[model samples]
Target: MNKSFPAIFALALFLSVLLFNYAAAQSTVQERIKQVENNLTENLQTNDAGPMNLQKRMEHYKVNGLSIAVIKDYKIDWVKAYGVADAASKIPVTDQTLFQAASISKSLNAVGVMKLFKSKHLDLFADINTYLSSWKFPYDSLSKGKKINTANLLSHTAGLSVHGFGGYEPGTPLPSVIQILNGTKPANSGAVRSVFEPGIRQQYSGGGTTITQLMVTDISKERYEKYMSDQVLKPMGMLNSTFAQSPAGLKRGLLATGYDVGGKEVKGKYHIYPEQAPAGLWTNPADLARYIIETQLAYEGRSAKVLDQETTKLRLTPYMNAEAALGVFIEDYNGLKYFGHGGANEGFRSGYYGSLAGGNGLVIMVNSDNGEIIQELINSIATVYDFKGLNKTEKIKLANVSEKDLDSYLGDYQLTPKLVLTITREGKQVYAQATGQSRIEAFAETSSKFFFKVIHANMEFVKDDQGKVTKMIFNQGGRIEAKKL
Candidate 1:
């Protein structure tokens, strides 16, 4: 009985240690989640607005639903969903709820195209017309006789027209790819023609991605969605994702209803994207996190489930010194390198970012047109996780200005040939709207200077010697002087 007593004591000690470690790990996860949910920020600053909660931010932004997935150590650390998927039905969003991936679809399309390149089924440098069978690109002198290649198309250096598409509402007549490319009747956008010489610069073109969609169908003799699912998504374990133009079967109920910035539900819930390669993906963040992890692992030469290390490197490499690498954009935050893409459909906005070296990243999807909340949530997660080179916030304070002074700054300013900033006054508030963008309220930092609460942008009203407003210097990404017109 003495020998048995020792064994029993050891078993009890082992169980105690296991339970203690488990409880500690659970507590750590809860703390991380709590920090992320409460620390939302735009510029990581403390102002009158103060620290924001995720639910409050969602309400403030008029976002109806949101899904997020966080990646740590090359795996999905956690995924969370918030708000109602359908306000009318009060259907709550869940981890499985699907949102339009929008332009993130291009990232996966690039992977599938690279798979073909790896199999020797296609060549990256070959003229795109070589693989295209159903239709041919109408090359004009704008192309400078430079034939569009797979690399150009993937990297957005093909000089193609139609930056994006406004998808058809449910039950609306959808245009065929050929019709869309030709800019014919019933097509919502212009032709996908060469706007400049290929390989000169990077211009985002979802139309170019659509051409690849057709190419995949033409060359593989399979539907674009099927090809992508079988070749890239399934192998990477993104089982919940699909490029189907319309949600069907079990996906119907899982789809989140789209909402406008005003919190109004879009008619028919959401638009149908026939251009599957650019804006047609219906997926959740957990599935996208899988793709990010696979990309990280493959780049590290640890996995070749879909793309091998050499091919993944080629896909991530920028073409012609452009900021874009294949379908993803390469950006440096502080000093950390990241490759990711942002997507915006008519009523859906989504974005994802993954580290170039580490397996750390995040994916955010919202069912509202307003994208202001996406970055704020990312900032919160970065802060809580102590991610390198992210969540750098600055303190800012608002200044008091007279209503009469605000009225004087109201006018139209031309920043460029195509860009204009229109400042309007409503009662005591001032709002600024750029051409082709929604109106955003501007709060005064000084009588002549104003800043936006939702975005990292500022405006300074410049006056002439006579104290008359002449021009305004717009500062957001950079400074640009716009003459008051």
Candidate 2:
């Protein structure tokens, strides 16, 4: 054989090996994705409805678009997107599609604000009014003379009014920070004022988070978005995120349209959140995964990209015997600690859970008002990844019951002084609604027992000696009680 022939044969062999390895790696990733899509479960065994196909569940829940990022060993393993970002345009959601982060904004806002504390520019325990130069907090006797501190505000222990915000429609006039705080005409929410003494209890308040937003703007003397982007977002390598009140210029095209529970598009496609610090974040799950990874690394003292180890520890620590931490919530799931935050703004719902150790985490974003799908997806990822303390689901099977039998369970059962469980029926389907909440369908597990698909709660209709339904027993969170009206 000629010398040229030998050289050509060797080069061909090298190319074949490289191609084979690349194909094998792609196949492995696809297999893992397929596995994750099929197995979704919840913490409670009774809540599991068996192995589920994620695409089918998306159809079942009418979720238009979803994005998820999985973190392994302190880095993002993969990111997946599904459904249409804009149903009208049929634009598919991609790795770059942006969804409203909603209350998840608070988590990052806390980081930016904490940086101030770390730099000794602000005191975590100092009275918030001390740094607030523009507007003063309207304190009253309800405060019990307990001044609201930066830590209390960040932890939602400031006892402020307004649990959350109902973002303004795209065309509606957005309120200024001061206008929102005073609950002025342009503001759709109530005034942000003290409801009770600060640090007394852990009650959620988006209004309190807004106060911190103002504090950042006032103290930094820079726009909230600019300060956050420079100090936190850019530092953490989250280039795809923004706190813009409206989707303008090039960012508008990247935004996923919001959808309601009925599968209808939101009136303006998506709401505009002027409360930037609390609900204005527009980002994708891939970008959020970066935040989670940074948090995990900082907590472990391996990295301080955005926050140092000591500050990260303070951010994750629970306050006032409550699971609520600074902007995020700390939970011990089966012994593994998780720091996370959930966001809901009109037709958008997002959540992220990052392990305090082990560098494991997940971030999910959906452009739908119905959030039941988010948890299911999280369960699937946790199961497929074998995330410690995450898998706790058992299979559940529904029982068939007659429509007439279901009608018998229709009635109002009072649970507490202000809460009532109302059961209703339509054809063969049964539904349950609590006071001040939307109605949810309840699937029959037995003639007298029913379970909710959206939540991990169950109901049992109790009968009297005469075989007539007299009360309804609600079982949830280890509490079982009979309610009769």
Span of ten consecutive residues with least summed lDDT in model 2: 40-49
The most accurate candidate by lDDT is 1
- Residue pairs in clash, model 2: 45-394
lDDT of model 1 at position 19: 100
lDDT of 1 by residue, 1-485 (tens): 99799899999999999999999987887888888999998773535666689998888889999999999889788898999889999999999999999999999999999998999989999999999888999898999899999999999999999999988878878888889888886788898999999988888899999898888888889988899999999999999889987856874458899999999999988999888998899899999999999999999899999999999989988887746899898888666778899999878999999998879999999999999888888888888887766665667776777877787799899988999999998876789998999898887777899888777899999999988899999998999999999
TM-score: model 1 vs. ground truth: 0.89
Regions of model 2 farther than 4 Å from truth: 1-22, 42-49, 392-440, 443-447, 455-457, 471-485
Off by over 4 Å in 1: 1-16, 44-49, 397-440, 454-459, 462-485
lDDT of 2 by residue, 370-443 (tens): 88878877778887887766554556666778766677788899888889988888887888998999998887
What clash count goes with each model? 1, 1
